[model samples]
Target: MTATQDIMNSETLMGLLAGWGITPPLIEHPPLHSCEDADRLLLNRPGTRLKNLFLRDNYGRRHALLLTRSDKQVDLKALSRYVGWSRLGFASADRLRRYLGVEPGHVSMLALVNDREQEVELWLDQELQTGNDFHCHPLRNTATVLLSKTDLQAFTDHTGHTPLWLPVPAS
Candidate 1:
C-alpha cells in the first residue's frame, strides 16, 4: 500500500458502501479543493455540508480526523486543549497519504476504510449531531456523498473507529 495506486478511489469507496448495504446518494461535480468550492457548486444540495481536517499532534505520535459544519470556524488552539493534545497542526501531505491513503483535498470520514490499523481517531463536532444527514467526499474531490446519521454510524462500526463526539470550539 505504499504507492498512491493502493489508495481507495471513488468507485472503490462506493462499492464498499454498497457492500455494507449503505448505498448513499453520490453527486459528481468538478474537483473541489476547498469549502468555498463546495459552497459554490453544491449550494442547493441537501444535508449538512462538512469540513474535514486531518491533523496530528505536535509530536506526530497521534492522528485525528476532525469533522465539523463547513461554515463553522474551529479554534485549533482550543481544540488541542480540549482533546488533551499538544498543539495540533495539519498533518503533512505525506503523512495524510500514509495514514488516510488520500491526498489533502480528498479527506473524509469515509477514508477511515484505509486505516486498517485503526490509527487515526475520529472526532465529530457535537453541534453537527443534530443534523439529519451529512455530506462527505467519497475519497475524491470530484464527488459528494450524502449519508444519514445512521449510515455514518454503521460505516464507523464497520471500520472499527468509534467517533468521539465533542463540542469543538469555534474561533
Candidate 2:
C-alpha cells in the first residue's frame, strides 16, 4: 500500500496514538475558528499548549514546520536567520495544500504524514520539551489533541523527520 493511504487525519491520528500504546486524555470539541478559540476552550487546563505555523522561505524551495508556545510572538527576522533562510513568511493556503497536502487552517505535524518524501523540515521550540503536555490541531483546526510531550516527541521521531530545536527567548 502507498504511504498516502496512511495519511493521519483526526480519527486516524487518535488511532495511531492508540496503536502506539498511548492513552493520554483526548479532548474533542467543535471546530475552533481561530487560535483564540482553542485557548478559550483549553482554559483552566493543565499543561502547556502550542500554536503551529507553516512557513515558506522566499525561494519557496524551503518549507518549515514552526511549533511554538501559543502566546509567543514570532520574531520572523530572528527565526529566518536561525534557519538560514531569507524572507520566511506564512505559506499561502494553496502552498499548504500543494506541499503539506492539507487545507488552510488545518496545518499540523499530522500534515507531515503527506510529506513522507521529506518535503518540509520541522522546527520545534526547545521550550516545548520542557513541558509534559502539549496541544495541537488534530489534522483539523476545528479540534485539538492533547497529548504528553514525550508522546509528541516519539511521534515526530517515528516520522523520521529530524526536528530542529529553536529556542525563542521571552521578550
The parts of candidate 2 lying over 4 Å away from their true place are 1-7, 40-42, 169-171
lDDT of 1 by residue, 1-171 (tens): 345446777798899899999999888889998899866774578888899999999999999999999888899999999989999999999998898888989988999988888999999999998995788889888888899999999999999999999899999
Per-residue lDDT for 143 in model 2? Answer: 62
In order, what lDDT does every prediction score?
Answer: 0.89, 0.74
Tell how far residue 94 is off in model 2, in angstroms: 1.3
TM-score of each: 0.94, 0.85
Clash count of each predicted structure: 0, 2
For candidate 2, list the clashing residue pairs, or say none.
Answer: 31-142, 32-142
Candidate with top TM-score is: 1
TM match of model 2 to true structure:
0.85
lDDT against true structure, model 2? 0.74
Residue 25 lDDT in candidate 1: 89
Candidate 1 regions exceeding 4 Å error are 1-5
Best of the candidates, lDDT: 1
